[model samples]
Target chain A: MLAVQTIADGLVLGGLYALAAVGFSLIFGVLGVVNLSHGAIVMMGAYLTWFVWHTTGLDPLLAIPPVMLVLFAFGYVYQRGLIQLAVDRSSLLASMLVTFGVALMLRNLLVLVFSPDFKSITPGYAFNYLRLGEVTIDLVRISALAASLALLGALAWVLNRTRIGRVIRATAQQELAARLCGVNARHVYGMTFGVSAAFAGASGAILGIVLPFAPPDEANWTLNAFVVVVLGGVGSPSGALLGGLVLGLISTATSQLIGPAFPNAMMFLILVLMLMVRPAGLLGNAFAASR
Target chain B: MLAEALARHRWWIALTLLGIAAAAVVPFVLMPFHVRVGQMILLSTGLGLAWTLLGGFAGYWSFGHTAFIGLGAFAAGLFEVNALGTEFMRTDPLLGFALGLLAGMAACAVAAALVAWPILRLRGIYFAVAMLGVAQVLSELTNSIEAFQGSLGLVLPRIPAFGLRTEAVFYYLLLIAAVIILAIAFLVKNARIGQGLAAMREDEDTARMLGVPTERYKITMFVLSAALTGALGVIYAHSLGYITTGSVYRTDFSLNMIVYNLLGGIGTLVGPLIGAAIMVLLTQVVLGSFLNLHMFLTGAMLVALVVAAPKGIMGGLAGTWQSWRRRRTAAP
Candidate 1:
């Protein structure tokens, strides 16, 4: 029964990790750099959702769309304004450093407004748990899981079916070829970045429910996103989903088997092991193939 | 003709001598707090310079370089507590100090070489993130292990002999360390190994095709840097007196290294020194009320530097000079 409950909980966290990793991987897929600020975007989304809940007393679930939209705009403007210049440099390290810079800015601004103290959003139903015989799950975790899976579904649909998705994928595959095909390179890149940010924001909102966060949490979030993307494959969304689930289980199991401090260590160990054993990751081979 | 060249460069010679003299006497000139700040600058500059050799020169960019630092600190602390008996550790801290630093250096070099050999093959972001993970794992192990004092760390039994005059004692230590780091960096920048690293940075494939022993060169440099950085960590831990996993195993130091090195001029010899000075000032002076704001400034500076001048402060000036010279030649 305990085992069943632990696995179920791992799946819930995995769903959340998948949502977080997808946006991060998408940005990496479309753009060569691993948008270091993706976690900050998620952090921003969490704060925004918390704000909506704090001021209007709205259900946090309903707040995801507006938060995602705002984050999308923010991401678009950020890419067009600053990163456009960096992208031209054509160095992965430079772009990653650039986003690290933006992340620092965002983290500081968040701290300026919110202070360095940890904050969490708990709606009335946050504490409620759904019990099913030997298995039990927190309602908040379930909602986060459901919300993330739904968004993942929507993202998968867009990437596989839609025109914009196809353009974004083509650009990822070959930027010059895509540009020659009249793809409006900057616009497509900006749109793809915005979508990626929106996904991050949604994940952030869910993160607020699952855990308490301060300004520095963004760095950890970014690290986890990287671990997920690398584990899944650099440019694969479905790969991200699987990676997230695997990380979730691994982290949860580590916490259960060892101690809480061990999970963070385990995540990195797995990452190191993966890089050494299979740099392409479980689903990573398609990364260079597409991007 | 040689005499004329010497006369023309007289100002540079005078300034260089003047700078050395000033550094020698700085302990007496500044107040104790600022002396501490100077010590900070020396430490940061030293760390940044060490990082420059690996990330800046070799183009590997290990975001987990802090792992070496944490391990060094832990190794030093463990040596002081476990190896040195309480009696000897208290009275002859100088002996323990020397041994602690040596232990830190040996442990760091071994760790870096062992890890770098396998991990360096991954390339780019994977290598960077993997390095970060390595650091995180080491830190966590320190946090969980009782042998590491289990997050409480260790208090170096303070022998007043070691810090009879805190300002003079550490200032000289830091100054000497910084000088050594800068000197080694200058030496490395001019050597055959340095040229190999430059070639590797520009294009590994081309360098390899040209018969550069890129693997051996990278591991050697990485080990050298790890030893240097670990030595710096020993000094840092000693100065602090009390060292803990949370305090010593700071990943943020890795970020600072990257930022400072990049800000100063990623590959330039003097860039890290300049960058570290500016960063230490901001961190110490303007830290309390505006801690997060400082972070914002650091980040904004990074973004701006990368976009407008990817070469950093020193690199930017060099770029301008080259461009201006080209323009002048073409003006006719």
Candidate 2:
């Protein structure tokens, strides 16, 4: 029963990781810059949803659209006003510093305004669980997982089947080629950031459904996202899903069997080991050249 | 040309060193509280200078430098904390400080050497990520390990009647460290090794093709960087009179180190010093007024620096002055 529960929990956690990592990997792929601030963006999503839900007494899930929309605009303007300048200067150090600085500012601002207290949203269904013969699962977990899978599907459809998707792919693969093809690479970059942040914000709201969050908790999510990106491969959408599940299972199993604190170290260890053993990550072929 | 340049600046170099030595008195002359604050500023300069080798010079970008720092702090803690499983240095006082510092240096250097081989094979972002992971592992390991007292942390025993009040002594020691680090950076920057590292930073394949021995030089600079920073970590740990795993390996230190280097100007000798002073002043004088807005302001400052002045204050100002001189001459 415990084993079944852990596996079930792992699956739900994996869903969260996949949802977050997709956007993170997307930003990395298109911009060629790791959005170090992605975690803060994720945190922002959760807080925004909670704020809307708390004040208006609205259904928490209803807040997703507005949360996503706000984050999307923020990410877009953030890329154009700040990140584009770094890109223009053609400095990796500048981009990294700027993203990190923004992330730091966001983290601190959240703490300053929110008072470092952990905030949780209690929808009516937060504790209601669906029992499966001898095992039970929270409805929130199942809904969050379904939402993530849906987001992943929508992301896939956009990337694989749409015009903007093609532009994004072209810009990511070869910015100059995309430019020569009459695509505005800069605009595509901004669009990519917007799309990715929307996905990230939605996933973060889903995550907020399950886990109460504090300011520093965002860094934890960011680190896990990095693990997912590395485990899955930098640019592979499917790879992120697979990697997320792999990590979720591993961490769930480890934490269940060992101490709770051990999984963080273990996850990071696996990440480093993966980088050494396979620089291209698990699904090596898709974006092997990224490193 | 090189000889002429040195001849022109020989007095300037001597005067600077002399000035640092002379300024050591300001700490003792001022109130004890002021000395303590000065000590922190000096410590930042020392750590920033040491960081320049890998971060600025070699361009390795070890983001998890907190690993070395934590390890170095623990190395000192082991001697001073006097737990059930410790030996040596316990019987002796002065010998402990000397041996403890050496141990700190060696531990970080060896740790860096251990990971450098596998990590250095990768490039840029990958290496940075790996370092971050390494730090996480080390911090966790420290917290979980019984020898580290399971994160409750250890308090160092104060030396009985040590020369110069402990605070003043540590302050002077920090000043010396800052001076030593600056001297080492200057020497390395002017040497053949520095040029090799510079070449490797610019283009490793080209440097390798040019017979620059890229791997050896990178590891050397990295080890040296770790050793110096590790040394500071030791002093920092014991100076606190109590050290904890979380405090020593805090991510803020690593972030601040990176920001200080970038804020001044990467790859320049005086940049870290200039950056550290400005950062300390901002934190101490300006942001000090805010209840908890320091981090926010620091982050804002970092973003502004990167956006408006990516080359940093020193590099950006120099470029502007040079361009202005060119424009004036052309107009004439």
DockQ of each: 0.53, 0.58
Between which residue pairs do clashes occur in model 1? A233-A284
Which parts of model 2 have CA positions greater than 4 angstroms off? A286-291, B1-9, B83-92, B144-146, B159-163, B320-332
For candidate 2, list the clashing residue pairs, or say none. none
Candidate 2 chain B worst ten-residue window by lDDT = B81-90
Could you give the CAPRI-style class of model 1? medium
Could you give candidate 2's per-residue lDDT for residues A82-131 as a string of tens digits?
89898687487568767877888999999987779999988988889999
Candidate 1 per-residue C-alpha lDDT over B148-180 given as tens digits, one digit per residue, 9 for 90 to 100: 884776886553444347666877887888778
Candidate 1 — which residues are off by over 4 angstroms? A287-291, B1-18, B159-164, B282-289, B323-332
- Deviation from native of the Cα of residue B246 in model 2, angstroms: 3.6
